[model samples]
Target: MSNWNGNWESFARDAELAAKERLNEVDRISESNQWKVIKAFQKHRVSDFHFNSSTGYGYNDRGREVLDEVYAEVFGAESAIVRPHFVSGTHTIGIALFGVLRPGDEIVFVTGKPYDTLHKVLGHPGDGTGSLADWGVGFTFVPLLGNGQVDWEGVKAAVTPRTKVFAIQRSRGYDWRPSFTIQDIEEMVGKLRSIKDDAVIFADNCYGEFTEEREPTEIGVDLIAGSLIKNPGGGIAASGGYIAGRRDLVELAAYRLTAPGIGGEVGAMLGTTRSIYQGLYLAPLLVGQAVKGSVFAASAFERLGFETHPTWNDPRTDLIQAIRFRSAEHLITFVQAVQRAAAVDSHVVPEPWDMPGYENPVIMAAGTFIQGGSLELSADAPIREPYIAFMQGGLTYAHVKLAVRQVIEDMHSRNLL
Candidate 1:
């Protein structure tokens, strides 16, 4: 705690103490996750030579091929397409969704609305931008029950003969509901299979990787996609995303990513192979650190009389920590203060307005090495009712601790805490 104690305002001293006590449980989970990563590394026989880069047509790119093999093995999938070309998690999911569904195919989201960026990909309300709907693919979602559980009856009524894809978002995205866990995803898979035997079950796995010991691919999901800059990036990968699952599905996604026949074979890794491999190697540890920070944030904010999701000791499914504020002013201030705590762009203040893909005006404190890296320390929220601030990512537990303390001190100085 020395890093925080030396300069943190005295107002946060009690919060720091309480946060430290709560860290014991976090440490237990992190330690277990650490061993899991080591076992995966050992099982795959990862070596320094595998970090070598490939160029040109990338023919016989053993390093690239082996990296995919390792990712597939670790994710418990038959195949994987991990590349820097897929710009974002949304892009990766788009490839998987578009690859599997035909023009007349219907896509059903059993997990309610997806992340905001996906709304554009799905062609919501038809923006005429070559979205899924524009391509003649149909979409519908079964809203979650009040308890955040899937409305099975509604899902049953929603599925049609043309329903070819059952999409599940493993993370909560901007939603207030709890993110789906591995067990929950497993149950959903069973239920979906019982209804539509051939439906391609896809999981948007962003921010949800390496948190649980087993992945969605390990359970029963047919395909899983995510951004490399999030959980699996290990705070080191500067760009890219990954999709891993059944070989046939991954092959289809690979075709969507590159071309009709090239698939995952021809893309040049450039100079990113080493970093991507290293990032995946370190992902479990980084995710654990982020989860710890989330726990600390939740615990500290709850002590300050704010409502927090998945209260401190609760099992974490993703890295996000949400604190519901009383008013929009409090939410904006909280986001601004979080930006101030950032090591990068601390001087810049964020304002809530219409961000590109969101419905509500969103404020974001994105101070990170990678432009939009959510696996680093950052906070953001939509300016709306409930006024919840969602904070996530910390490359290290200490940084997350410092950031959470800064938020408390900032609120206290304003007489809001």
Candidate 2:
């Protein structure tokens, strides 16, 4: 690609090679340490890859029984609603917010800004006239610290008796995108609840699942939410959203979805328990490997003379690390390079596109339409000038290494070495 040293092809190769070397080291932990805990909750595998719950539900559908098991396992909740409903991650956050609060009540988002989609779903006026403000409901945002941690003091100031929900987001792969552990949320919830007993501490738990030392629900979140397709579904669950919390909270969310069809948390396919089930089984291992890949890629990018976020050897991550290309053209071309390298499907092409709910026009090199930024199969990078986010999901960490190689090769082919 370059002097055989500077080009990305060589970079990707070296990165992938590094990943292979770590396989035995990482797999040992994946197969034994992580696998043992998830096996008790295992149902079955599907599509030669996905997991089906013991209750026989495939993608967390109409059957409430299996969802219960998943909730217990992931959130330590008595009940949960893990449905292939809610078109995307943002929709899921909206459902949880609506499920818990009344019109007169308020929701104090503890952790600063949410994911871009969630930011829009929460109805930011900056997104151009939509959302809770259009309706009678209220929404407020609390700023984070310089380091990106929550301004707990500000949260305390914002919480009033009118605050029915105090929400903290766990997934750190968006906005400022720095990973925070579940322990962070647990401690936040504890502090918030100590002040207000009736308030529900909520978590927008997205790409951050299975990487934490402890689950948020175990620590104290009244409700923990995320996309089943992202972390829990093991890169399966064609599409879905999940909410796990206290039993009453889950039931309340269900009622909101059913009531007047007020909340549209339902996806076209009500049942794919298989994909989600398998996703969970492969989850621990896939996540470990993905994290490992991130570490490797971050190091390679640093060596490539690019600014990288999230160091390569970090013990914990939300599963995304980005490098700055500094120019719009470079960002788009980089995305194209990675996509050209990753997917098996020839029909899928990488292109710049806009998302439905972001303030700025976010471009991505996505191959298919399973919601462009899906944390599956790889090769999707969202546009951030001077920065392109390379993320992975739904595939083995081994696959992530291959994708990294492809990205490096693509970079070399384009002569950006």
Candidate 3:
């Protein structure tokens, strides 16, 4: 088990001991979540017939329709639209926004600037990609306070009659802030309702699903959107996204996804129905493993004198574990080392390049079985100042533990540890 400078054995021993209790807790949560999903599946009578996929116009797709119902029931939403047509998490979120917002309406972001992919989606007027701004919708953001908590006073000042939507991002994108919990969302929903009774509150629920027993929709969020490849897909959903919430709001999103008349009635599943259902069935357990890996990684990094966001003991509502390095080289090496430890593409090296939809040159180490699947073992970071590397996901805790050890050994060999 010795690696790099040969001190990894000692570190691994400590990490295992330190992470024992946390891992047990994760196991407990996984059990509860597994039961919940099982009940949802049973309640919906998901049988082999639901596994069949559709093609062409995809009309009379009972499996597709029932999957939505099961998801709605599980999430406690009035209605849901789950489709392979929606490309990524950002695209699903875009559909939801465009579906609800009208021309001259304003969208207020209470969680600060969103992830890089969103900048293009929220493009300025005439950028010509048919962005919100191009559609004559306005955007405003209220920066979080020094502590990364939402600024209540700023949100109050920002809300207006024209503010049709108040958006909340549960996961802290590339930022060093803590992810918002269910309780936090509940409070935000309550406050927003008081401020503007009619304002729609949409939650970007990417990477946050299954981490908590309850979802944002269960707590009164007007609408919620997530990518299937991230959390809900359970690492098996090849492609797709989900938008669930109030029936009217979901219907609007469905129109955007398909057409004004077709809505969710059309769109073929194309043989992905079974995988989607199975993935959702397994998501809770996989998410728990990922969360445990995150906790273990955070503790391991912190023990070695590196700074980790939402320390190991902190209540986790997402899978991201951000580790700050003193230099860019240290950060880059850490990412490269994770790639070296990959089960799929271990031989391939990753370099920082101009990735689409990102403002900065980014480096990503994703050797997942499913291309671009973040729920599997992966690590990525922007080549930027402060040199923070965000590591997330593992299909199994054993794999994540191995990846973290490899990173430590690589850093130690370079005397960066």
The candidate that achieves the highest TM-score relative to the unseen native structure: 3
Q: How far is 35's C-alpha from truth in model 2 (Å)?
A: 3.5
TM-score of each model, in listed order: 0.94, 0.82, 0.97
* Ordered list by lDDT, greatest first: 3, 1, 2
Cα lDDT tens digits for candidate 1, 292-388: 8888777667766788887887777889888889988889889998888889999998998899889999999999999899999889999889888
Clashes of each: 0, 22, 0
lDDT per residue for candidate 3 within 1-417, as digits (tens), equals: 222345667777777688788778888888888998889889989899888978899989999989999999889999999988888999999999999999999999999999889988899998888999999999988999999999989999998779999999999999999999999999999998998989999999999998888999999999999999998999999999999999999999999888898899998899999999999999999999999999989888888788899788888899999998899999889999999999998999999999999878999999999898999989999999979999989999989989998887788778886
For each candidate in turn, give its C-alpha RMSD to the true structure in angstroms: 3.1, 5.0, 1.9
Off by over 4 Å in 1: 1-22, 124-127
User: How far out, in Å, is residue 255 in model 2?
Assistant: 0.8
Cα lDDT of model 3 overall? Answer: 0.91
lDDT of 1: 0.86
Winner of 2 and 3 under lDDT = 3
Model 3 scores a TM of 0.97
Which residue runs of candidate 3 sit more than 4 Å off their true CA positions?
Answer: 1-5
